[model samples]
Target: MKRYTDADTYDNKIPSVVTIGTFDGVHIGHKKIIEQLVEAAMQNNLESVILTFFPHPRMVLQKDTNIKLINTIDERIQILEKTGLDNLVIHPFTKAFSRLSAGEYVEKMLVEKLNVRHVIIGYDHRFGRNRNSNIIDLASYGIQNDFTVEEISKQDIDNVAVSSTKIREALLDGDITKANVYLGYNFMLTGKIVRGKELGRTLEYPTANLHIKENYKLIPKKGVYIVKSEIENKTCYGMMNIGNNPTVNGTHQTIETHFFDASFNLYDRKIQIEMLKRIRDEKKFDSVEDLKMAMQQDENFSREYINSIL
Candidate 1:
């Protein structure tokens, strides 16, 4: 898919069928909308365009610094690329852009900049300064601007809303299964391998410590989880822990993964780990031996779970 970062320079020669949203997780409901968009574009012989914003409008406008996102901008783009979109536009969401009136947005961004022939949007979609425009206003604008507006069904919109909420809640609750069901894919954590205290090696379970750079990307609940990753193009299953190691008297939270039967050094290598299921809550053990025993049990259970799925 062609990706354009500058909205002002987005001069598509072909007329486009567009959909605009944050599309945060690109969950199942969002996938449905994207499917409809692609179908509409094919039927009308127009380019399918997705206009999304970076820095999430809420983060910039409302100064919601504590807000966590399911995917980083790059991760969102990677996920959207699989949906067969013709063009993807990542526009900067600045305060000045947010101040544009509804009419100006439709005329300048949609009609002139994107050459939009049609728009597929949710029934409750709102835009303009302080969200002054609704779907009805969009339709009115479309009528005046010579473009068509397709309102996605209310049921679909509600489903999308519910799915997004449930997915976020499930992930925060460590319900990976429920989150994946709504997302239509495993939740992933991308990070680089970093050095730890080498404590896992002492337990005979050497681990790769993950260091994620995106502060906005949501980390799952503190617990142990069954995860999978591709190392050197080979799929490997592992058990990951997200917590402060109470047994070891560690104070800082860490993401440590111990791949079964793998011994290769991964320091400084970037990797993506897909969470498949939650194993158990992290616990403080009485002694090093007790923690080692618990780790063995966790590994055994993880192997069984992975094997059963395969």
Candidate 2:
């Protein structure tokens, strides 16, 4: 798939069938819509395009910084590439861009920049200045702009909304299994490995500290989880802890993983970890010995679960 940083960067000669949204998780419901989009493009002999935005509209317009997303922009790109999309445009969402009139957005971004022959959008999607326009307005604009508009059914839109909300809630609650069911894939945390206090080394469970740069990426609840990562092209299973070290009197939260049998220099190297199952919530053990014993039990449980799956 060809990716453009912005809609203006695209200079497509072929007409396109387009879908516009944040597509946060690209969960099962979102995949259903993307499947339809690809099929529509194939049947119509048009390019399949997805136009998404960064910084999230809420983050820009409302200054709502607490909104966490399922995937970072790069991660979203990674996931979307596996889909059968022809083009992907990530536009910058800014206050000025949000001020555009509905007519201007349709004519310029959709019709001219995208060369859109058809648009697949949500039934209740709103756009333009002050968010006054709806799908009905989009249809009218499509008629004027010489394109067609396809409204994603209300039922499908509802499913998408529910799925997004549920996935976010599941992640925040550390319900990895439930979230993965809705996502159609494991929930991943991709980030750079940074330096920690090296406290885990003394515990005989050396760890790689994962530091995610994106503040908007949602982190699962404070707990230990079964996880897997591809390091040096080899799949490694591990147990990960996402929490502050209560027994050690640590204040800041951390994401630390101890791969079962894999060893390599990981500091400063970036990696992606996919959560497989929730093990247990972080606990404030009575002593370092107790904490070590708990971790040993977690490792045993993780190994058994991993073996069962294998």
Candidate 3:
């Protein structure tokens, strides 16, 4: 699939059937819309285009809103690439871009740059300087520009909204199973492995400390999770802890994964871990031995869960 980083980067050579959104999480509901989008483009003999935004509009327009996204832009791209889209455009969302009027956004970005021949959008989607334009306004603009607008049904839009909300809540509550159900896939955390205090080594369960660069990526509740990752061409299942090593008097939150039955020098390697299930909430144990015992228990629980799936 072709990718354009911004409106300026798009060549406007292909008249396309387009959909636009932040498309966070790329959940099952969002997938349904993309399925329709691809079908529309195929039926109409045009390329299928998805125009998404980064820096999330909220992060730009409302700087104080501490909003964490379900997927980082790179993660979003990784998911969208599998959806049969013909083109993906990730536009940078900035204060200057947000100030475009309804007509200007439609004419400049959609019509001129994307060469959009048809738009498949959610009923609740809003645009323009103040988000003052709705699907109805977009339809009117489509008429003026000689394109068409297909508004996704309220039911579908509501499902998308509810799925997004439920997924976020599930993740925050450490309900990876529930989040994956709504997402139609395991939610992943991708990061580079960095050297951490060798406390895990001393405990006999060495871990690869993960450092995620995107602060806006939503982290699931601090706890233990059963996870899997592809490392050096092998699928490794592991138990991961996302928390501060409180027993060691460590105050910074860290993500560390200890792969079962697998050993590798993973420091400095970038890895993507897909959460399978939530094991348990993080606990503050009485001593290092108690914490070690708890880690053992977590490993047993994770292995059982992994075996059940296998």
Candidate 4:
């Protein structure tokens, strides 16, 4: 798929069948919209286009508020690319772009610039200044501009509509099993291995510490989890600890993973860790020996659980 940053880079003459939204998490609902876009584009022999923005609009509008993103811009692009779309447009949103009226935006971006034959959007989707655009407004504009506006209704999983907020709540509560059910896959973190204090080695269970670079990515709550770690593209069973090591009086929070039946110099290497299940809450042990015993049990449980499942 071609990634176009703006109209100047989008030199294709192919009529675009476009879908526009934040597409946060790329959850089931977003999947439905993309699937419909793909089928519609294929049926009409049009190019599939996705229009998203860098630095989520809300983050720009609400500066002081804490805005945690479900996926980074790079992550969102990766997900959209896998959906078989022909063009992915990441418009650089600015103050002037945000100030455009709804009608002006539709006329310029949808009708003239993109040459959109058919535009697909979610039922609750909105655009332009003060968030005034709605499905009816889009349809009216579409009628005037000689184009089509399609609204995709929400998709539900187990009577609950799949949403980014719900997934965030699940992760905040350390309910990754339920979160994965909503996300349609395991939650993963990819980062480079960094040097950490030599604490785990003292306990006989050496760990590779990860330094995540994606600022918007959310980390799960404090706990240990059964995980699958890919080091140099080789997957291995592992146990991950996500918390401050209270047992050793550590002050900094850490994400440490120990791979089962694998050993390598992981320093400076990139790794991707897929969280499978939360094993137990992080706690302080009575002594170093007590912490060592607990670590043994955690390792054994993680190995057996991952072996049975995989």
RMSD of each: 1.0, 0.7, 1.1, 2.2
Q: TM-score for each prediction?
A: 0.98, 0.99, 0.97, 0.92
Q: Model 3: per-residue lDDT, tens digit, 1-310?
A: 8888887888777699999988899999999999999999999989899998888887887884578889988889999999999999989999999999999999999999888999999888899989999999999999999899998999999999999999999999999999999999999999999999979999999999999999999999999999999988999999999999888898899999999999899989988999999888888899999999999988988888889989
Ranked candidates (lDDT, high to low): 2, 1, 3, 4
Leading candidate by TM-score: 2
Instruction: Name model 1 segments beyond 4 Å from true.
Output: none
lDDT, model 1: 0.93
Model 4: ten consecutive residues of lowest lDDT = 153-162
Q: Tens digits of per-residue lDDT for model 2 on 188-284?
A: 9999999999999999999999999999999999999999999999999999999999999999999999999988899999999999999999999
Q: Put down candidate 1 lDDT per residue, 1-310, tens digits, no spaces.
A: 8899967778679999999999999999999999999999999999999999988988998899888988988888889999999889999999999999999999889988999999999988999988989999998888998899999999999999999999999999999999999999999999999999999999999999999998889999999999999998889999999999999899999999999878778999999999999999999999999999999999999999999999
Question: Alpha-carbon error at 13 in model 3, in Å?
Answer: 2.0
Comparing 1 and 4 by lDDT, which wins?
1
- The clash numbers for all candidates, in the given order, read 0, 0, 0, 0
Q: What is the TM-score (0 to 1) of candidate 2?
A: 0.99
**True-vs-predicted CA distance for residue 91, candidate 4, Å:** 1.6
For candidate 2, list the clashing residue pairs, or say none. Answer: none
